[model samples]
Target: MDDLIVKTVTKLIIPFIQLYGIFVILHGHLSPGGGFAGGAIIGASFILLTLAFGIEYTKSILSAKVTERVEIGGVIWYIFIGLIGIAISGVFLGNRVAGFPMGTFGSVISGGMISLITIGIGLKVASTMISLFHHIIEED
Candidate 1:
């Protein structure tokens, strides 16, 4: 049954995928993965959850409206943070001028802007994907 497929995928794949997404978000500053990749992975996780749990369960976790707000708010938060760099650092997204103490490479919270942006992007992406799921599954 489709339900079994969805449930199994949700239970098994989501955790690892989400962990990988977090890794992507966290490792962004040191390596290739960044906000975009992290965000996308979070989004994928949500989609899988929705498919497995069904609309009602999904809504329990995140309503479509809430997801929309989260997406918008994340973007706003990201913009605001980036703007701080602009006003002080003299360039957009210029986090360096803000004087964030860059920690050891590959450590969580090591890269300041990279971490902040990754969080913002993850929320934005998760919410966006949830919204998309609501649009598709809510009708069913």
Candidate 2:
């Protein structure tokens, strides 16, 4: 069935796309890329999969309601993380005191709050994209 084929292809493609996205996000410090760029790539990857396969196929991975909730949750988490710095350091996302080390360049934990922001951005993009895809598919 088309369903099985699409499902198989989507599974095969998602990992590579997601890995590249995360690499871009995490490597933002020494490079031009950042959370936004990486997030966009990841979101676009999902869109590609959706287009290649089908919205119904994609929805099996995550429902519209789940996507909406995840989007909202990511935003709330991002805001909370940003505010934490202000509470203690008297500045929003003040990296010097957010607790994470500004370790050596290229290290696993090099930047402070950068990874957190990247993760938040990635999740936000992914969920928003899912919601959009769901809407588009529903219009049919």
Candidate 3:
């Protein structure tokens, strides 16, 4: 953690890693990567940070309360999106029938609620991984 090389490398690469993760999540509906892959990527970035900087430092950045809230928020967001389908189409996760606009094809925002769902899933997966990592590391 005190090594300048590792710290510098982590600082340099963490942002890009996180950016890629977000990209994966956003493009999940249109591409191969999705919530799970993107979330794992994001979680890996945090893991890298923890490895490079130490648990205490990572804790300062992402406290227990904040992580819990984020996780819960992701779950709530997912449920809310599903509820929209129920309200609109009387079916859970109803896409077009729920009146979600299918935008221009091949566009980033073209997948109706798919993008939103994946975003929520990505958040949940990322938080879950971080939490598990923290717990496992703290088990000592």
Candidate 4:
């Protein structure tokens, strides 16, 4: 972890990895990858950071409190979105029937609530991964 090359590489690559993860989460409705995949990618970046830097440094960036909040917030957001569907269409994740505007075909906003759902899932997964990793490290 004291290697200069690793630290430099991690610092440079983490942003791009996170960006790609966001892209996957956003475009999941239109493409193959979805929230889980995107979240895993982002989580891997954090893990890499922990490896290159240290647990204390990683904790400084993403404290336990913040990670817990993000994990809870992701679930709450997902549930809120589902509730919107139920309120509108009497179904838990009703998309078109919920009166959500489906954008033009093959576009980013074309999947109605799907994109939103994936966003929540992505956040949850990423935060969960980070939390789990930290916990494991602490145990060791």
Candidate maximizing lDDT:
4
**Which ranges in model 3 have alpha carbons more than 4 Å from their true place?**
none
Per-candidate TM equals 0.80, 0.80, 0.95, 0.95
Model 2 spans with C-alpha error above 4 angstroms = 1-12
For candidate 4, lDDT tens digit of each residue in 1-140? 69999999899999999999999999999888999999999999999999999999999999999999999999999999889999999999889999988899998878788888899999999999999999998775
lDDT of 3 by residue, 1-140 (tens): 48999999999999999999999999998889999999999999999999999999999999878878989999999999989999989999889999999999999979789999899999999999998999899777
Q: How far is candidate 1 from the true structure (C-alpha RMSD, Å)?
A: 2.4
Rank list by TM-score: 4, 3, 1, 2
Candidate 4, residue 36: lDDT: 99
lDDT of each: 0.78, 0.78, 0.92, 0.94
Clashing pairs in 2: none
lDDT per residue as tens, model 2, 1-140: 36777667877988898888888887777677777788777877778777767777667876677888989988998988889888878888788786656878787677888777777887887778768866876785
Model 1 per-residue lDDT at 127 = 75
